[model samples]
Target: MPTEYHDLSNWDIGFAALLIIVNGVISVALKLGLEKKLIVASIRTITQLSLLGFILEWIFQQNNWFYLFLIILFMTLTAGYTSSKNATRFYSGMWINSIFAVMVSSWLVTSIALLTVIRPETWKENPAQFVIPLLGMILGNTLNGISLGINYLNESLINNRGRVEMLLTLGATRWEAARDSVQSAVKSGMIPILNTMSVVGLVSLPGMMTGQILAGVPPLSAVKYQIVIMFLIASGTALGTIIAVVLGYRKLFNSDHQFLYERIQKR
Candidate 1:
C-alpha cells in the first residue's frame, strides 16, 4: 500500500509562512498602511481555522443528526449576517431575504450533490463528516454571491434613480423600471463564478483538488470531486444571487409603486 501522507511539523509550517513576511515587506515598501489590517487578518485566519479543525473533529465523532443540523443552522445564520453587512442600512429586510436565498440554494444543491454524485456510504453511517464540510463549501460561495448582489443592487438603485423615476413617470411598471438594475446586480454577483469556470484549470488549481492531492488522494479522483463541487458552487451562487437581487429590489419600492428613497440608509 502507498504510504500515508506525512503531516507538517510546526517548524515546517513556519517556513511556509515566510510568504506572509514578504507580504508585510511589500506593504511597508508601498506605503499601503495596511500592516495592521494584514496582521489582524493573518491572526484571524489562524485562530478561526484552528478552532474549526477542532469543531470538525468533534462533529465527525458524533452520530447525532441534530448536532449536524444545528451546525448547518449556525452556518446559515452567520452567512446571512455577514452578507447583510454589505447591504445598505435602509434595507433591514435584506438579512431575511439573504438568509432564505442562501439556505435554499446552498442546501438544495449541496444535498443533491452529496446524495447523488458523491454517494459516500459514510454518509449513512456518520453523515456529519461528509455533509458539514460540503455545506460549508456551498454556503461560502453562496454568501459571496449574495453579498455582491446586494451591494450592486443597492448602489444601482441609488445611482440610477433618475432613470428609474423617469420610467415610472412614463407609466412603466415597477418591474419594468427596475428590471435593468436587478439584472445588473445578478450579473455582477455571478461574474466571479463565471470567470472561475472559464479559467479554472488553465489559470490555477482549485483549493479542494490541491488539498486532496497533498493529502495523498489520486489526482484523477481529486479532479472529479473538484468538478462536481464547481458545478454545485456555480449553480448555488447563481440561484442565491438571482433570489436575493429580486427580493432586495422589491424592498426599495412601496405598495404605491413609488421609489422609497427615504428608506435608503444614509452613509
Candidate 2:
C-alpha cells in the first residue's frame, strides 16, 4: 500500500493473464482441455469481479456492522447461485440449503477469528484490509468444499440407494440411512485442507502468511495469523460440507427414497 496504491498492480495483471493462458495451453497440451475452461473462466471472472469491485467500493464507505452483514449476505447469495449451478446433479433450488450451511458454519468460524481471536480494536481501521478478505476467503472455500462434497455425495447416495433402503427397512432414521455417504463426501472435501496442512511448512508457505512476511510482519506473527486462518478454514469446511449434505440430503430423494436430479441454467 505504498502511497502509490496497488489495488491491481501491473505485475499482478500481467501474471494473472499470463497464468490464465499458460494454464489453458498446458491443459490442452496434456489433453485436459484446460483451454476451454480458461477461456470461459476469463470472461466469467472479469465480468463478475468488475461488478464486485464497484459494489465493494461502496460497501467500504458504509462500514457499519449491518453493512458488513449485507456484504456477507451478498457473497453468500452469489456463491450459492453458482454452487447450485454446479450441483444440479444433486438438487435444484438449493441455494437455500447452501446459504443456510454457509451462514451458520462460515460465520461461526469467522466470528471466532475476528471477535474472539484477532479482536481488532476497531472495524473502521481494517474493514477493507483484513476482515473482508478473510471473510471472502472463508466463504469462498466453504462454498467450493461443500458443493464439491455434495456433488459426490449425491452420486454415492444414488449409487448406494439400496444400502440406504436396507438400512431404512431396518429402522434407521432418514438421516441415518444417508449418514455414510454424507460422511464420505465431507471427508473427501476436507482432504484437500488436511493435505495442505501436512505440507504447509516444508512444501510451500501459504499466500496469506507469506505475503504478510514480505510486507514486514514478523515471522512469528505471520505464522500465528496463518495458523488461525488454516484452522478456521478447516473448521469452516468441515462444518459447511457436513451441514450442506445433511440439508442437501432432503433434496436427493422423495419420501420413498427416489432421487431428484435436474439441470442448471449454465453459468
Candidate 3:
C-alpha cells in the first residue's frame, strides 16, 4: 500500500464546513434556541484547532524538551481547570484536587506508554510526537471522568445526606458512611469510556484509528494503535475518577469520622 495520502485542500475544508449549516437549519426549524451556541461553538472549534495546528507544527520542528514540557504543562493545567469548572457543584479547594488528580493520572499513564510501548529513538531529546498526542488524549478523557465523578459525588452526598448522617450516627466510619456515594461516583465517571470500549468497532470507528487508516496505515496497525489508545483512556479515566472521588471524600469527611456537609456548596 502507498504510504501517502491526498492532502486536504482549502476548498475541501470549506465544503466540509457547509455541513454545519444542517445543524443551523435544524436549530432554526425546531426553535431550539441553539443557533447562537452552534455558531459560537463552530467558530471556536475552527479557531482553536487551527491555532493548535500551527503551534503543534512549530513544536514538532523545534524538538526541544523544554518547549514540549511547557506545552504539556499548559495542556494539563487547562484540562484540570476545565474539569473542575464543568462540575455543577463546588467545594473548598476542589480545583486543586481536580488538577492533582488529572495531572497525576494522565501523566503517569502517558509516561508508562511512552517509555515502554512507543519508545522513540530520541525519546530523551525529543518526545513531542508521542507525548503530546497521547497525553492530550488521556487528559481529555480523564478530565471528563474527573468532572463526572465530582458532580455525581456531590449530588449523591447532598441527596443522601440524611442516610449518610444516620449511618455516621450509628458508629459508622466516615468511609463507611460515604462508601456508596464514592463507588457510584467512580462508576459514573467510568461509564463513558466503558460504553465506548464496548461498542467501538461495532458502532463506530474511533477518530485515531480512522485517521491512521486515512493516512495509509495498514488496517491491523491502526487497530493496534486504537487498542492502545482505548486502554490508555480507560486507565487514565479510572485512576482520575478514583483519585478525585477519594480526595473529595476526604474533604467532605473529617478524620474524626464526621461528615462536614457544610463544606459542599452550590456553584
Candidate 4:
C-alpha cells in the first residue's frame, strides 16, 4: 500500500494556474475562440465541485438514509434534466421520458449493486458512502449514453424514413421497421462504456482508481473498486439507453402504426 498521500495546499493550486495560462495562450495564438468559455467552465468546475464536496461531507456526517436517498434523487433529476436538454431539441415529450428512464434505471442499478454485488451491512451502516458516489457516477454516464443514443436514433429515423416506410408497407411490425435505428442508437450510447472498459488499466487509469490510489488505498483494492464501478456503469448505461431508446422510438410513430415524421422535427 502507498503511504498517506500529501494533501494539496493553497499554494499547490497555483501550479494548476500555469496550465490554464498555457491553454489560454494557445487559444489566443490559434484564435480558437474558446478563452471565454474555457474560463467560465473552469470557474464552474471549481464552484460546483467545491460545493459538492461540502454537500457530500454534510451528507456523510448525517449518516441518514433519507438524506442519502434524497441526494440520489437530486442527482438523478439533475442528470436527467441536463441530458433532456440535448434531446428536447429533436423531439417533444422526451424530457419526461428521459427523466423517468434515468431515475428508474439509475436507482435500479444502484440498488442492485448495493443490495447484492457490493452489499453493505445496511443502508445506514456501511453503504451510504458507497451508494451515493457510485450512483452519481452511474447516473452521469447513463445520462450521456441516453442523450447521445436518443439523438442518434432521431437522426437515423429521419435519414432512413423511406427505408423504414418501405419495410412498414411490406408488412413489417413497428419494431421491425425501426430495428436498425434502435440498434444503432443503443450501440452509440453503449460504445463509450465499452471502449472505456477495453482500455481500462491499459490506456488509462480510471478516475475512481486514480482517486483511490491517491487516497492511499492498496492498488489491488482500488482496482477491485474500479472494476465494480465500471460494470455498474455499463449496466446502468445499457438499461437506461435501452429504455430511453425504446420509449423514444415509440414516440416516433403514431397510434395508427404510421411514422410521425414531424415528431422528429423541432417543435
Give model 1 RMSD, 1 decimal.
Answer: 2.3
Give the per-residue lDDT of model 2 (tens digit) for 86-196. 764645656778778888888788878877787768554746555677888788778888878877787787678678878888877777888788889888878888888
Where is model 4 poorest over a 10-residue stretch in terms of lDDT?
A: 119-128
> What is the Cα-based lDDT of residue 172 in candidate 2?
77
Model 3 segments more than 4 A misplaced:
22-35, 122-125
Best-first order by TM-score? 3, 4, 1, 2
Candidate 2 lands at a TM-score of 0.75
Model 2 is weakest, by summed lDDT over 10 consecutive residues, at: 258-267
Question: For model 1, how does the per-residue alpha-carbon lDDT over 24-121 read when each residue is reduced to its tens digit?
Answer: 89999999988778889888988999899888888888778888899999998899778877565437677898999999999999889877887867
Clashing pairs in 1: none
List pairs with backbone clashes in candidate 2: none
What is candidate 3's CA lDDT for residue 193? 97
Off by over 4 Å in 4: 28-33
The candidate that wins on lDDT is 3
Instruction: Report how far residue 61 has shifted in candidate 1, in Å.
Output: 0.8
In candidate 3, position 258 carries an lDDT of 88
* Model 3 / residue 184 / CA error / Å: 0.9
RMSD of 4: 2.0
